[model samples]
Target: MYFTIRPARPADVHGILTADIAAGRTSPADAERFAAGISAAVADPARLVVVAEAHDDANAEGGTGVVGWAKTHHWDYADGPAPAGHYLGGVTVRPEFRRKGLAAQLTEARLHWMWERVEFAWYVVNAHNEASLALHRRWGFREVARGARFHTVAFDGGEGVLLSAARPQA
Candidate 1:
């Protein structure tokens, strides 16, 4: 699909919510809460939220709409194996758009943003998510530790793998 990645705007919140709903993450009734959360992130200087907009071949410069989104969250841990830094957040895309490398592209964009401010990028994933683990490995992420919980987040699968990738010099 022809698309471009860019920082999300307030108007993109609805499209992002649509994606989340399509992924079965939430219901349409929760749009207000979702929009508020996204709005806060967009307004925060310490956090980064980006979207991938699909474009028609004939109108590549003007997007058709937001097809996917990814974000990062800053976590300050007073005491934990997970250090205080910006952590990789989740990526969501329309179901029809899965397995097309859109996730990788979104991840690369987040890493690029992270690398500009930190020496290492951190991510915590469920141990059972082999696909995500495999995808991240291609970006140089390696296991730092494994636990039932990291910082304040707990894995639904009961075990989470904490991984980090050093910033590659540009």
Candidate 2:
């Protein structure tokens, strides 16, 4: 199968959200909010959002459609004074598209984008998500920290980890 990867555009937000929801990684409302955030991120060159497109069949116009996405944020690692690093999150792939190497491609591209500006790239994965943990490991992302209050939404809280992959020196 052929894959086309590229930096996501503001107009791709809805398609991205749809893919995320289809993967069962996020709710409709959460995906909507994330879509808006993605648009804003795209407007800022510092933020990186990448997508992978795969063709459903041969001889199709556009050839492939969006199958997955990865987002990296240029934000502070800590609320207090400290050197800030790129935080990558919000990775999602359609259920039908899983295990097809799309996520890894998107990840590598996003990390490359991050390497251009930051010293390190980090990501948070829910502790219960063994699949994500394994994927991160396979990509050379090491665990940097662990915590219970890793993320909070409304009344929901979950355990997660901070993982980082070394970026090639320019």
Q: Number of the top candidate by lDDT?
A: 1
lDDT of 2 by residue, 37-121 (tens): 7789878877888888876457355845678998877764563221266777667888888888887888888877887776777
Predicted structure 1, TM vs. truth: 0.93
Superposing every Cα of model 1 onto the true structure, what RMSD results?
Answer: 1.5
- The Cα error of candidate 2 at residue 159, in Å, is 2.6
User: With candidate 2 superimposed using the best TM-score fit, by how many Å does residue 12's alpha carbon deviate from the native?
Assistant: 1.1
Q: After superposition, how far is residue 115 of candidate 2 from its true place, in Å?
A: 1.3
Displacement of the residue 39 alpha carbon in candidate 1, Å: 1.1
Q: Worst lDDT window (10 residues) for model 1?
A: 75-84
Candidate 2 segments exceeding 4 Å error? 29-32, 80-83, 150-158
